[model samples]
Target chain A: MFVIKCPYCGERDQTEFSCHGESHIARPENPNEVNDKEWGEYLFFRSNPKGIHYERWTHDHGCRQWFNVKRHTVTDKIIQTYTMGESKPEDNNV
Target chain B: MKYSLLNLVRNSFSYHENWQEAWSSPELKKEYDIIIVGGGGHGLGTAYYLAKEFGLKNIAVLEKGWIGGGNTGRNTTIIRSNYLWDESAALYNHAVNLWEGLSSELNYNVMFSQRGLFHLAHTVHDMQEITRRGYSNHLNGIDAEILDKEQVLKKIPYINGDGRYPIMGALLQRRGGTARHDAVAWGYARAAENLGVDIIQNCEVKGINITNGTVTGLETTRGSVKAKKVGLVPAGHSSVLANMAGFHLPINSVPLQALVSEPIKPILDCVIMSNAVHVYVSQSDKGEIVVGAGSDAYNSYSQRGSFDMIEHIMGPLVELFPIFSRLKMLRQWGGIVDVTPDRSPIIGKTPVENLFINCGWGTGGFKATPGSAHTFAETVATGEPSKMAAPFSIDRHYSGALVDEAAAAAVAH
Candidate 1:
């Protein structure tokens, strides 16, 4: 277990936060036009990479806000954290 | 050398020094009819069956590490077939049937102890869920029996019946039990190698060579190897491999941790699993209590879990079995499990031609090793999923025909 710098609540234990996997998947604007495969891809397919993953986390116990975390999947190290509306960081050196 | 009494007696004359190696580390071949990625039990078993049953020739199994060094050796080794769905029941029960004769067929002592497995219920909802699953298992010709509190206590008197989250009842699958996890891998490897299937270790697949959306070969750490029909069985890194082939699997690789307590006199004779309490424990033949905990909240490939997970299970473990309160944990390790949305495995052809994928067993792939390899060999050989594996094809995610076994998974995700 590690500490998470929650964008809204500052630093907190990882237990206080909940990870909602793979952030920034936009829903189709015209859902009625998308085919079954496209809809399924949106619903199920994930880019579960071995390294350099951008994901969502919610501070369930502390500030109760959602944010994005750019972490290394293999090392479990958090490189950066930003609020939900903010764009992904350009420099992902880790 | 076939392992037998005569062989044992013959080896004893040489002070057990002249016994041959179980399997050979052959040089990588340039091409083969089939190439199985990953040297775990599932992959090795797939190669074995492809050669033995399907009469396939020139098959190879590539391993990034030593054989059975991945999740195959890391699982808790709890084997059971009492599933809630008909599809899973059929699939898992096929493994159970093969497991019954695996030791004899492979000429190896896998030590499969069918000491019974009990799924305890602590709450009303758990009771209902297990009752439904037990009936479903019976209807599917698999064995299951629901026992009330008295019957549960009568069988396992050591369990605390009046503790916090008291045990109300349990669903017992007498045929379910543990096996020697490493032996299962070694046995399959040796048997597969004896059938002329090449077992190559320290061979990592660096890239998938796909031409015109069909798998042609793989570039490996050792060298490039050609195989038109390739079966991908890399368990936790499945999505990584899929990405190499211009596709993605609906999989999330997460760490699942298990620990064993210091060896003591045998107290727990059977496996006791409580999904409600989130603790499963079984005593090894060497007398250490093997305990399993739930997965961590976040995804990880670190092969280690949070300390809170230990505290989480220890609290309920002591509540259920006060005897284990003082036993020190000997060692703890984690395995990266490839979890799916519906908690069922994906065993079928991939989008890339001649590329078969057998993965997404999530937290319980070890139990389905033999059955998965058996059916997957057919899928790889004929480019079509066997009847037993058809329901678990990749198309299920699109058609929404999921086998949904999250409840019966025995671990609360």
Candidate 2:
């Protein structure tokens, strides 16, 4: 079992957390203005990058707070764990 | 000699040393009518159908590793067509039909056993969902029966019918069962090879050479090879291969792990799946209790899962089968599954011309091998998606017309 460093709860067991899939996929500002294709892309498409992935994880069992995690999808290495509003760190140079 | 009793006896007369290789290792040709990347079950099956059904002889299947060395061999080989959606139900039902005759059609023993499959209901909601899907299956002309708690107990005597997640009922698909995973690939490879299809192993595709939005050739580890058409059946590597051709797929490659217990007497004769509790178990022909669970929460291509995942799944399994608490797990392995948002597959032409892809099978591709290949071959052959494969086009994502099977397929896959 790996540990997830929740921005609020510090390091905790993975069971305490729940993944929220790929991150940085903001909702469209105005749904009425968006076309069906754009709306679908917003709703469905994801980077799902093999290397570095920016995802959201909620410390549901612990702090009940959600945060962002920049982890490598292939290596499972957490490059950084930041708050929900913080921009993704540029440390995944590989 | 053919794999028959006469050949067996003939080989026995010579100390059983006259056996021929099931398939040939042919030299890669400079160019082919079609080049199928990834020599897994789907790729080999596509090649087999292309040559056998479509009458396409100049075909080559390129594998980065040996055939069936990927998800094809790693899956827990459960076959069922009791999907929730009509499109999926129809597609999987077609696959099940093909599987029933695959052994005879291929002239190879694939060990297709219809031992039945059960999806146990752990909650009232689960039972309701089962009832709903059973009705859907019925409308699709698929065989599905809702069994009460007593029937589940009768079918699986060892299961703790009254555990924390008590068994309320189950959805039984009597025609669904298991097949020897590797044999599916080998049978297709051998049959495809017999039809003059090249099975080139250890040939990794490095780059896709496309000109004017049309696929021209592929640069491989062996060398550059040209093809008029290309089919990508690379499973978890679908996104990676698509990236080479300047396209991105909404596919995530996640590691799905499964384990097998040591050989023992057949405790379970049929497949038992608990989607609510997240565990699937079936006894192999060799008596090993095969257990599989949901894919790891995170994405990974390492072909391995965390110990926490195994622990999480084993708890529900052991709770259901108290006798298996002591059964030692002999082996554990993982496969990278390419999951799509809809949890269904994408089988049609891509933005690139002369390039077709059949992937996004996610956690359940092995069961759909034959039908996937049969339709994929037609799609590649005619440069148009067949009636069976038309609904699974890539444009579905944009059109918001999705075959959503995510919840139903979650743990059961």
Candidate 3:
């Protein structure tokens, strides 16, 4: 149960939170151009990397706002937990 | 195990509701040897064990509302022990063991059943995780097996099996199942009440009267009550009660919503979970298809089941159980869950003397009732945590020793 430090609400339990997978997966601008496989992969595949992972988080129990978070997958540590509208994460930090 | 860890975990006491115990009277008995708050399963179960196992009586259980009125009654009423981690695996297995014998132990039918639980997986990764968890739980003495799509189809033909959100594989456990939620609570309540523990209801606790860093007693709706020991089991409302005592709890409260389709023929035998959809389903004994979704990120005390939640949960349900699309939506409700930073529950003592806590069940609380209550009672009586709970102490969070339960607490659980 990682205690996420929501920027809006103080630290909250992992249960009062939702994890939106792989924060930087942008949808292809041309939907018709992407094949069915690519679309499915984009929708289904997520990096459950053992190391640092960029993800979107929602403080469901407190603010009800979605935020971007740079979290460690292996250690369950929140490197940086921020709100939803943040810019795409820099992969170098991960 | 470090005794300090048990005492410290209560520090992240995510108590959000007012301490409104419907039963309290200072003048009647100045002080009892022990006090257990929140007369739900854990509190009452603690008293029962204290008297039967520890040879201790004179216990009091105070509840603001009727027994099992909290998450105990609100939960979807399912139980399983397939876990990836060692600490949680053993603990839940022990709880399942207790459930096997609980009907005879309580001498009242709690409607306990071992109808089996099947974890549905859509992708190879989910199947691998299930395999990992299956091995872990098996090593911890749980009975688990792997099932392919053909086996799943054989078990319940009603489940949809298209390549879209296809069924890659599953983790089947014959030992895990559900019981009557209200009956389980009432069984514990009546049994504990009969054992001479003051099962006080309609009593609200307002404040914990302390002095010099010691828990003297508590001021409640009825009156002041003194006690040598106090345990809080307020569930989602756990944080607010902790605040009155000046405890800095790290947990936040969230409303977890669940809905049921109108009564249909019982199609699902074992529990069903969709890793791709993040939705799980199981039909109750009453024929209502109980479905739950992950919590919506945000804080609101409201219990109104959202349209968005239905839409989000339904997408997974229809993909998995096509029959559910036509089933009329029945009653939908929400319960406040006291979630901990690490998806695991904080079930131990507090820093203050004579003050013990058992909040932070999150979504994992119901599956852990027997073991949690057993070890929690042991801790409150002896002021030490059991080996099973040593890893989940609240102090670990402060010391960067938090138990990462992302793999364990995922909706796949």
Among these predicted structures, which one has the highest lDDT?
1
lDDT (tens digit, per residue) of candidate 3 on B1-413: 11134434644374424423323332335567888888778778888777777878788887888788888888777888877777778778888989999977776677887888888878888788888878877788888898898988888777877747788778998988888888778777666655667777877788998888888888888789898888888886676678777774556555677888888776777777665678878888889998887774443334443346767787888888776788887878777776666677776767677788887777658878888888888888887777877777666555556565665646523
Off by over 4 Å in 3: A1-94, B1-30
Error of 2 at A48 (Å): 1.9
**What DockQ number belongs to candidate 3?**
0.04
Candidate 1: C-alpha lDDT: 0.91
Worst 10 residues of 3 chain B by lDDT: B19-28
Clashes of each: 0, 0, 38
Query: On residues A1-94, what C-alpha lDDT tens digit does candidate 3 reach at each position?
Result: 4677888888877767776555778898998898765664455433334356677777778889888888654344567876666776665665
lDDT to native, each model: 0.91, 0.90, 0.73
Over all chains combined, what TM-score does candidate 3 have?
Answer: 0.76
Error of 3 at B271 (Å): 1.3
Write out the backbone clash pairs for model 2.
Answer: none
lDDT of 3 at A66: 80
**Residue B147 error, candidate 2, Å:** 1.3
